[model samples]
Target: MFQPRQMTKLLIAASKDHIEEVIGELYKRRLFHIEDYVRNEQEEWSGYSIGTSLTQADQISSELVKIRSIINNLEINEEQLPKADYTKQSELSKKIASDLPDIAARIEAILLKRSGLEAEQKDLEQKIETLNPFLAFQHPLEILSGYETISFLAGYGKGTPVLPSESELFTSPVRRGEAFNIVAVRSGQLAECERILLDAQFQKVVIPQEKGLASAAVERYQQQITGLQSEIKAIDQEFETIKKQQQLFFVSSEELLTAEIEQAAAPLRFATTEHAFVIEGFVPTNEAVSLVTSLQKATGDKIEIQELEILDLNEEPPVEFQNSRYAQPTEALIDLYVRPKYTEIDPSLFMAILYPLMFGFILGDVAYGTILLVVSLAARGFVKGSEMGTKLIQILRNCSVSAILFGIAYSEFLGTSLPWHPIWLSRHINMGGSASHGVEYVSHVPELLILSIWVGLFHITLARILGAKNASVMEHGEHRSKLMFAHIGWILVMWGIIIAIWSYFPLLLMPDLTGLPLIAGISSSALFGGILILIGIVFIARDNVLELMELPTIISNVLSYTRLVAVGLSSVAIALVTNYIAITMIIDPALKNFTAISIILLIAGIIVFLLGHTLNTALGLLGGGLHPLRLHYVEFFTKFYRGGGKIYNPFGMIRKYTEAEK
Candidate 1:
């Protein structure tokens, strides 16, 4: 489509009672794009105000939050869930009212219980570790502590302390890592012994609060830990079961509640009085009547609807692309750069056609194209949710098709000629490739390069024409005419340069155009081209003297297209070299001998061939993808495009897991 869908403004004013039904129809049908209302205080001393959210919006929101919390606690990711079961909205609402609270309470209790049990298990594990170290002492726990007359210290340190001869001291034989010690001293002399232990880098460890041998206590604690582990495992199993059972319900509920909340809050964007409400929005002209009829029917024809032919000078309507299915993928790039304004022409169709041709021209190869097609097909499903990524993949798919078609034309399968002669012209004739194909065709390198320049000329000329049209629409007054003329001047200058090159050096420049009718009519083509160039410069200078500086761009932009030839030739050369090293030098010699050494070389050569081609394929995808986009962005779109349009965000939700009953 050349233009976006035509839109009409609809203003609806109705009694407050009909607002609920009206909102429901608008949301469910997904037609309206609401233009939010902002109240002005000085509007003739107005008493109107912005409407609040609809009744029970708060209730629905609270319940939605609880459902989300439950889903999160259960770690129920929608991606990992099985296919959702379709159910009526009414059924889902009833479940929310009756089923959610009970499920929420039970799940909460289980989580709380699981947390308490896990805490107890952690505490028991610590107790076991503490008691295990004391086993080396071979002492009853009660004897190590709770002494008033005698003070004791139990810890692990770098070395044993040097205590008084009168004090009782003990050290473990296992002293490789750290020494474990127990030392008792009289209460009056405890400080001196503590200092001596501290000096040895002592780290005090607490003795467990228990009685009996350390071994028995450790055994009892381990038993308690085992019990706690069993309870935790059961809780986990229960959670997994709940996740499986309620995954569909959770996903469906979340989507439904989200839609419901949006509808309920739709009133917030409306202008309201004590008894009436006003709604304003845009709808496609084709669908406008249907929307009005549906709303009136839903409200029993109680609402008053007015269609106004009003234009706001300051604000433009939101832009929704009206590209065909084939051209739609180009929207991603347009959005990435900047969306086209409502008044300007959409370039999706232009980009859709040119981008693939440019890409195929640079990376034409049947094998590479087939690989790209296969990869894009396999990845389509995974990127379905990502709109931009999906569009890019689709673009890749389209470009690959172009590449295959061009590869056939160039007589290249991967890096060599096909079994038959090319359907179109071949690129490799001058590179000794004609001998293998046995066609003896002359190389078209110069012709292709000339063709590249011609492509640039046509593309830039089209851009100038589009730019002039856009200037007429977007520009105004004296400046608009001047700007339009500047675009025209560039076009003239580019054509002049091309004609001069053809007249002076026919073979070195473009394919011989001397026999053409236009060239034949001109007595002195060089002089005619110079005159045209001078006139263009004068027109460009009329806008601003600085504009003349850009005159040289006509030359550079045309030469930029020469990359189409240079880059593609480089790719072909690489492929040729890879085949030569792999098949001709390595594999062919190995097969002639048929020995162990030969077989090994053959395998290595095959590896070399695959790796080489793999590298080339990656290079093709990158070069093919980026170069075409660069040519479009840098060389083509810059001439006409000045995108800064707002994206169209329609007021509705896309349902995925549930269906609404009629």
Candidate 2:
């Protein structure tokens, strides 16, 4: 655990193949690309590509095709992207990209039929509208023959004088073909004319009648319109079927291309000096040697490798940003629960230590701990799916083993009292006196509080050490001093108190300890030491009086961990209360059945008990999880690490639906 691992950043100049190899290795190491900077020595490169140089140029070409497709299908009133000189060709390129043999054939078939069918259908519809007015025209003969005559007024005029007739009206300047002839009427009079004719060349004509002759011509037009409409419907259905087929063809073709493109583009290629090649990525410190050797052998000594300065030998780097493929299993588990606070802290290492500690202290129930371990091991070993969740589960499983170990010491099982409890329980009992219940005695709760405080002290000390380690890497001497003195001073204070308590208390079962007061005198010494430590912290941080107010803040932060004791006590108390209620229900003689029924009702109340306590436990964990991180991020990170460094990304095919080649 004390061994130091060296970290180094390497920069390499090599042929495209060698660079590709480096990127592939980094990717396998779980180091994701964050950004890429490509330099085109000549103006030949367009968009994200580096001219015609790299093997992955086709990937850029494909993206361009996608951009063009969006431009081509753009809706009216939508903002068009700024037009480059190649708008027309770009649209055409996308169309061709989207083209497929089966779809092209289907589109052709639909277009050939749709064009003629739509035109003919439109003409027929217009003819039907022209004929509809005749449906209102009525014949007087039908009324005389006991049929109800449907008489209607038809209007037509354009700058011609019209004379009214009872049945129809005729306008002046009428042409021969434009004449309105009444089929029949009750009387023929100038007042009876139902149609007005507008003449050609200002010539006027009038017919005195009570009926119109356009009905037969209109009926004949309607018949022809109806026939045309039926034909249009048949053609439309055929077009719809062809369109669906075309859509299927295009969709399937896209799926196939997406699957194949990455595999097809993996070969290495070359270009002239006009395009400067870039190979940038991360490599593990261990793998750096073999990679350098491989590059020398492959390219015959034309490569340049530049190693950047590595920081923070003592501190762990952030899990998300780590380039190591070989992080321990525990660290892998924690990565799922929390993102790293900085690039300097290794999540893997923190998880390795923290998991066991949390389980040992918080759970501390052998039976429950055993269950948790078994469940976790089963999930890790048997379950091959849910890779992320599985990793975290496996870590928790191992951590739970510590709980089992501590539980054996405490001799606890779900808070039930054990008469033959182990040596650990005896030690706690020696420290804090037992509780008596007239006929029986129970465990001590205050002792648990003291135990919790010690656990907190230990954990806090570890965190400070981690902080100091990071401080050394970042070249911040002040932070190193603050963490060093603060943690040691606190530990010294705690040790003095523990010694004083053990020696002074007579029932603690110790040898003659008359000089206990001298040991207790260390309390004053510890206090003075703490003040000095605080002075050192202020000096290193250069905190003003206002910042010193953060002392209260730090105390509040540390005190928040007391909830661990609060939650555990609450869980046990509620369970014990349940037992009391059950005993009352059985013993009450006057209303025994009523009491039993009331207890049954209380069984419904158990849901509230479960949920309320669960919520409390969750709150404790949340506060615990977040506060520690807050200390690390705000208090610790401020001491060292300025994490604004640029991340390394590369040129490659980036798609939402498809994976890219290395």
- Collision pairs in model 1: none
TM-score of 2: 0.50
List, residue by residue over 1-662, the lDDT tens digit for candidate 1.
Answer: 86666677788989999988888888877878898988888874288789999988998899889889988898887677776567689999999899999988989999999999989988988888888778887768898778788877788887656787769978785568677877788888888888888888998887777798999999999889888999899999999998888878888998899888998899899999999999888787788899999998999999999987647511456678998999999999888888887778899999999999988988888888899889999999989778999999999999999999888888786688777666645676445442332333545788788888888889999999999998888887998998899889888888887778777566744555565445455637766777888888877888788977777777888899898888888888778777778887888888888888998898899999899999998998888888778888888889998877766677787788877654
**Model 1: residue 98 alpha-carbon error in angstroms:** 1.3
For every candidate, C-alpha RMSD to the true structure in Å: 3.8, 15.1
The Cα local distance difference test for each model comes to: 0.83, 0.45
| Tens digits of lDDT, candidate 2, 1-662 | 22223334555555554544544433333432222335555664443243242365576446435433422322211122222222232333355456543444554565566667667767756655554433344543233223244232333435433444334432222344343232223244322344333242222222212233446655655677677667767766765565443333233334334333432332222221332444343445666687666655555666777765545432332222443443456444434344333444554555456556554555555655676677677777555545666656655666567767766766655444445555443222211232311212335556666665555555555655665565454445565555545444443434444444445553222333444334346544444445555554555344233444444444444454555555545544543343333333232331445655666566655555455445433433344334444434444334333443333332233332222332
* Model 1, residue 568: C-alpha shift (Å): 2.6
Model 2 regions lying over 4 Å from their true place: 1-10, 14-35, 38-275, 293-351, 370-387, 404-409, 422-440, 476-547, 581-662
Q: Going through the candidates in order, what is the number of backbone clashes in each?
A: 0, 30
